[model samples]
Target: MIPLPAGRTAPRTAPVTAPATAPAGRPAPGSVPPQRTASGRPAPGAEPGRDLFVDVLRLLGMALVVLQHWSMPVLSFGDGRIATGNALAAGNMWLVTWVSQVMPLIFFAGGAAGAISFGRAARRGLPAPAWVAARLRRLVLPVVPLAAVWLPLPHLLLAMGLPEQPVLTAARLAGQLLWFLAVYVAVVALTPLLVRLDAAYGLRVPAAMAAGAVVVDLVRFAGGLEAAGYLNIAFVWPAIHQLGLRYATGRPRRPWLIALAGYGAAAALVAAGPYPGSMIGMPGAAVSNMAPPTLALLAVGAGQIGLALALRPCAMAFARLPAVSRVLAWTGPRMMTVYLWHMSALCVVTAMVVVGLGISTPEPGGPAWLAGWPHWLLLLVLALWPLLRAFSRFEMPRPAAPYTGGTVRIAVAAGLAAAGLLLFTAFGFVPGPAPLAGAGLLLSALLLGRTAGPARRNAVPAPGTRR
Candidate 1:
């Protein structure tokens, strides 16, 4: 077992080492947060205390999300319209519900990583503003190009006189994905406060938040306003965020057990019909299990986190292989890019299958032929991998040196983002079509301005850094 660092009262634990020649740019087992310093370099190797299992958790969660979307079958209403009434829609909803919580797991993992990364940044004297900025850059950068690519797609369809509702639905879906970015950005912004809470009171803060979330759910389920459920976004997600902090600090004696209880409780809720069994969507159901996030979803997130942790050993073992390591190393850097591009890839594939291939209707339920569908799915997955790989560069910061800008830039950017959201909601600004051409334009501009050239110059590693 390795000796624990000073100020870390957690028990000593076995070290998880990296391969002898782990990819050059990868952070060490533990290093200072990857954020850039005033000198525009990442802090040198800070601590060798990272858990490879956590990395695998993030990777697996995203992969599951991709699979879930890929397996989804397109459905249409009786009049050849795409709506919620299609027969196959129910099964699709069920499948999505089963796996929807995977994303919450990803959030938990991210929270934990954020906690650890922030601590490392503080140790190296990186200021709070710089830390926040770095994180925002990483999150927003990859989204820029993706938004740009799709900005004109809807307009093209509308110009061709496509049906209004379908065009609107696709545009809405694009915007829905952006919700993750908004929520995640909010979480990252609150990291400093969350870290302080953890440093002072340990898990109690998060535990309270989680309890509050459940209470909120109970109220919402029992005659409270439906929109009240959205409150859990702040309460429950942050509570899970705290769990990530616990993982970073080594405070929990048995994190997995707590996670198990959460899982069981969630299962019970769904089984009892208080909440839907599927965490995704359900056809013919008035309310989606995910629309406002029930307490059961939180429980599922907890369970998923525990499961991921338990599988850490296997992930670490696999990551040790040279060939495996190479793939992991490459993908790890571009995880954000893969996530941003995957939905678009699905749209592309769906278009090819339906329009180009003259397959008017997607197979109902699973693939037309179960075994054969698996092979087709595999091919689709492989086909998308290269495209995802090519897009990875958009996610990485530029290699140039840092440039100075102050609060003005930030304020302006924030104002634009808010204004953009307002316009989108008020006018039903379609991200794709010509009439709503500027729907995502502001967001695109902000993202590009912050990601390209000088913005990227700040991403270099600090002197003497080993990770």
Candidate 2:
């Protein structure tokens, strides 16, 4: 969750850039003084100085997600067509994922970013509806294009010579990642309320949510009420999401101890508290703590937060290097784009190698697959550049007007985004009504947002672009 800074006087728009360096003279309280690097460009690390670990963790989380998708599907050509199955389906190695699950940190960062962005707007007298609208709009734009392409993709594959199974597989491969997007939108929708809860109750709120998750998991596993576990989506994420509560409350305390305690608890639960070891799912495994999050996953995230905090000072120090700062600066603004399109990039490579190149499956980790991995990575990177260039404009910070829209409209827009996100996650973008419904819902959100204040384009060029 990148806390994209909003402009105070006017409605803020997309692709927030570094504010210009202010003069050396001391600035007024509650205002940021600008700074630049040796390159004379805005030193992204300096001005308003975003937390490096947040950026680091975010980038790392996104990368791991891509890697997971990139590596998970075991693809091979058979009967002159591409076929795939999950590697995790077989091995008990999923136990490693208990410690490897990083999405907790991702959601935690999302909460903090939402808190920061909304707080900035509130200070400027920006309406709450508009603030929520602005946040949702940024989150939704990337999905529009994705749906546009994917909704029709299945039908097109069927029309082609491709078989039904492979076509459906491709469509699923494209859409499976939307679960994160869906859950994220829901958590974000609840941000303002969650922040309020923190203000009133402090740590108790997250503790309560975590406790509720424990109960849900207990019933889900004990009584075979697997459906009941879905509640953990609301429960488990908020538990981790609320860790940002400390930030929103202006209470500064050392979190390393909490992090340590979390890991200890998570390990104990996995080891002896009757929970499974893996934080992720295996295709045929009896229980998956991931698909419907469980206490094990939440504990993993809590511990991860602690680990991240314990390392922040060192991360910040390393981030200070000018080269690293510049890179972070570039990646920070485009993080959303990367998250949206990275999977698409991998899919493109899979298409080329398995379907196009007619490469057979390499015996599930046999020599041929290992030999081609470098080639696979190279192809994935090659496919990504053009996709980013074409689609990133959707993410440009558009000029926004003050939201005067009533709370009802805000709820409607959020409802649309949330519902649409859930639909997409459950069923990957599909033909006919699915795309229309999801994209249409998000599109309605944008329309409602404009009523608050119409977006007005600013003269500031999108950073790093050639005029």
Candidate 3:
């Protein structure tokens, strides 16, 4: 959820080479302020100091997500493709459980980024609808290409006489990754309201909200009322959402203190047995607090955020290096694309290994055969880089503008997408030829609408700005 800056470049970290001393009263060499634009703004490619920190955090978050997915073990596969069941054994569950809370961390960071992006757009006098449109375009655009490429691959394999279970297994796993986009879209739509909440009640409101979510979860757990626990999906996650808004506004006097409280609460809940000690333990435990996230999870997120803040100094230092900065700059723009496609890339690699290399599946809970997993993972990572490069362009944000003539076109596209989803539901459609074809049509319509440009004259860039 790192918001791509409207026009800013990544920070540079090339070391300054200068003499030890300057002539009397002269400014120290390489100490002069970076040059500014003709309009007194930092030059187009110059990174803003505050934004550098945001990018670093974003990079870290993405890395954690990648690692979590990589470490996840696959269990049973339908059609030998899509993952169907938990691969975790009792022993390994404890080790991998903490990864459950990672998504919440990602969303919290996203909420913060969204607040900043929308706040800035508002200041430029961008209308709410326009801002929403632009955000949706950036979020939704890359998904099209990913779905297009991946949806049919499994079916093609099946047609080529590949086993049914393996093909279906891979397709299902790929589809699950789309959940991020669905959740993120919902969160982004709420950004404006959350920002307003921050402006009015400050951090206290979100803190209180989080507490309430926790209480609701605890009561539900104690009473054995499963439906009640679902409330947490809305409450606890949104509470974190509001916290992100608070971070964007920069109003808290002691963020560290708030974060500590969250950590303490999380520890107490886990100890109390309201939730599992491992955030993502093996499937079929008597109590799976995470199935319906408990207060404990929220506590963990708060603690993590505090921890992130604690490392701000180190993150800033790392972000200032030129090579590191450039990589972040390049990757940040394609964050969503990478996220959506990484699992697909892994699936491709796995297929190649099993079919092309004749490798047998490793024993469920034993060491992966020959310790070859590291090599496999490395290859997957390498393959993903070039794949992402080719596809990231679809994900880049379009310049902002007003909607005009394309309203009907956009509506038709949305209608088609809705229809396709309904059809899939009724027919039990798998990710194969028909679904992929539908996706292509929907994506084409979306792209055309986005590229058609702002529909009206007032859609021009705001005075003295480049949003």
Write model 2 residue lDDT over 206-276, tens digit each, in one string: 88999899899889988789999999998998788788545433323466886778878888887884576
Which should have the higher lDDT, number 1 or number 2?
2
Off by over 4 Å in 2: 1-45, 80-82, 88-92, 248-256, 361-370, 456-467
Kindly list the per-residue Cα lDDT of model 1 for residues 311-390, writing each as its tens digit. Answer: 65677676544465455445566677666666566556545654445454345544554544576476567667887777
Q: What is the lDDT of residue 460 in candidate 2?
A: 21
Q: Candidate 3: how large is its RMSD?
A: 7.8
lDDT of 2: 0.66
Per-residue alpha-carbon lDDT of candidate 3 for residues 1-467, written as tens digits (9 for 90 to 100):
33232322211111111122446754333222333456875543344323555667667777777766665555333334444234454464554545444766676667666666665556556655555556656666666676666566766887899877766666666656554454465556566666666677777777787778867776787777777886776666777777766665453446588678867887677777757776653456766656566777777777777777666668767766657756865676777767777777777776776545656546545677338567767987987888888888776644555534344454454444444433332322265466655565556545644534544555655211245
lDDT of each: 0.57, 0.66, 0.59
TM-scores of all candidate predictions against the true structure: 0.76, 0.86, 0.76
Evaluate residue 213 in candidate 1 and report its C-alpha lDDT on the 0 to 100 scale.
84
Candidate 1, residue 102: the lDDT equals 78
Question: In model 2, what are the clashing residue pairs, if there are any?
Answer: 13-397, 14-397, 14-398, 15-397, 76-361, 404-452
Question: Residue 82 lDDT in model 2?
Answer: 68
